[model samples]
Target: MARVEELLGDELLEAIRGRAAGYDEANSFCHEDLAELQAAGYLKMFVPAEWGGSGYRLQDASRAQLRLATAAPATALAVNMHLVWTGVARVLQARGDQSLEFVLREAGQGEIFGFGVSEAGNDQMLLDSRTVAAPQEGGGYSFTGTKVFTSLSPAWTRLGVFGRDDTGAGPQLVWAFINRQAPGYTIKDDWDTLGMRASQSCTTVLEGVAADPDRVFRKLPVGPNPDALIFGIFATFEVLLASVYAGIGQRAVELAVDAAQRRMSLKTGRSYAQDPDIRRHVAGAALAMDGLYPQLESIARDVDDLADHGSFWFAKLAGVKIRATETARQVVELALRTAGGSAYFRGSELERLYRDVLAGLYHPSDDESAHATIATAWLGPPED
Candidate 1:
């Protein structure tokens, strides 16, 4: 299996970086970057080799995402949505569930999958859904609800969505996939944001859109449970999300180093790199990044190896996300301070990174949710 770095060469990254600013300025999707990545077969990184993909393990895929993010955080983030679904399929496959095998096969056939699970104000994070899934005449369901932050909106061929089905024995959460051309579904062009502008993560409105019987993959009771599907989604989503932020921090540190070296001090007749304070700031950011790298890689590897962490898995996954996001924020702040006023410019990479990292706080398992999850795991559930 070829390494991800090898697959995405330096030339490709430079090309992606060259176009990132233009896309951000226009607040559009990274079409050119996606085309290059698609040509390189990046979307199929997690698919099995027999399916004509590189068959990269989760750890390797996360590393590739980190590298990609360093060049263009928005591009990496947009692409991460596709990776999340494919990563979820890989996770399910490892656990002996072939329910999502078609996802892999579809990728091999040039299908692009987009995540459509995030609903506006639905903070329960997959435990609940604002969308309604009404049963059809024969089988399958018609989902009716709006999903926010639908990345790859302009290019996705398939969208993975979930909703509530009250017609069941109880209100069960229905998970399914719908084609982009499915009836009664619309992709709203309302993705203008503070950061990650190039992602084009617009709003997805589903109004009685039908999901084929074969496409309705899972139906489980609401709230926290031990379902493999839930675990797969949580684990893959958190890990990949963290990798992107970590990559942003990594880029910030690199920029900081470069700035410190080139910035000369008139009073001392030397560069900022020779100053103890500047050195300390860069070292601090590097230290924080060093801490996250191991956790990201280790947890991803554990998922790849299917190591059983039981109930602890959720806490660990959430922990890595929180750590990576918070650490990246701090690193970016330090980088900004180290780089001085120049980094505050609109076109500065650090300026973009600062905004991109903030998006991490809005992902599933936010700091508050993650802390509650950890506290509950360590001390049992709160009093009812």
Candidate 2:
């Protein structure tokens, strides 16, 4: 697989560039394209082995994410969320007796999942969500909440939601693997965005929906100990976001290099590629991306290792997530600066890349809250 990337990098890049214009115009990915991805079995890597997924290591997953992101940001973004949810489900399946057999079977069969963690009220109340899950008469629980920015809203067959229990154990999660044809669920059909427009991250609402007892697994708060299963979900998201930004950076450089070869500045009577300043800027952007790539992978590897070991280090994980997100933002910004004017014009691939890349910084990586946690750890008197 590694050798494949090296051999076909240029071809893959070209295809991504070819689709970039149409993808931007549509402002969302085509279902046919996503269905093709599912058919290729690329979506099954992070799923549990029992479910027919490869269940690769974090390193492999991150690498795959980067490769895909480099080609098509929208596909990468949508698929990454599904991968994270799979990891979350895998952990619950492993630690607890609750069988994810049905959903896992579907996932292995190439069904996609939409995430349901980012609710409008729960965004702030996630740690203490009022979205409670009350026990049904016989089994399962009824769930009600307003979730927003549901990535892959139109494409998924399941939803993994986080909420607190009436028991007051921090937060609990439930997987509502609803058949999309089911009632009591609605897609807002409103995902207009300045960038990453193809993500189609619409708002989703679930009212009076009952999750099967077999489908829902509880992630109760166990004091300071990290919820390894849940942490992987957030950490996976952060890692993928970083990979997307890194890809955008590389794509920017590729665009600039292509432009330089074609268009010449009348003033200097030299191709933009021949300009020393343009060359230097592109080089710098490459260097930044190169430096950050391994760093991002390292963080993801640590998160995965921690999850596997059932360990917790809140501050450290937060720091890693924040660092990767912030670095991705810087990398993409520098890429845009390197590309200059051609990147700013309408219908320019570079401009779209810039917009998609900028979305990374603004996404809820919890930088501020993570920084506070890091400071709290540092300022606390030495632990015994």
User: Could you estimate the TM-score for every candidate?
Assistant: 0.99, 0.84
Model 2 pairs whose backbones collide: 28-198, 260-273
lDDT of each: 0.92, 0.65
Residues 1-384 of candidate 1 have per-residue lDDT tens digits of 888778889999999988888888889889999999999989999988899899988899899999999999999999999999999999999999999999999998889999999998888878999999999987889999999999999999999999999986789999999998888898898998999998899999998999999999999999987888999999999999999999999999999999999999999999999999999999999999999999999999999998988778899999999999999999999999899899999999888889889998898799899998898889988999
Question: What global local distance difference test value does model 2 have?
Answer: 0.65
lDDT of 2 by residue, 1-384 (tens): 323254225655456546766877877664655665565566777666666776665667777777777777876787777877665555445556344546566789877877777766443423445455666666577777777777888788877765555644444544345557666767888988887777788887877667767666655552343554545555666666666666666666676567657777899998877888877766776676677767777777775554542223556556655665565556555555656676688787766776777676556657666766667677863357
- lDDT measured at residue 18 in model 1 versus the true structure, 0 to 100: 89
> How does model 1 fare in lDDT?
0.92
- Candidate 1 colliding pairs: none
In model 1, what lDDT does residue 226 have?
85
| Residue 252 lDDT in candidate 2 | 65
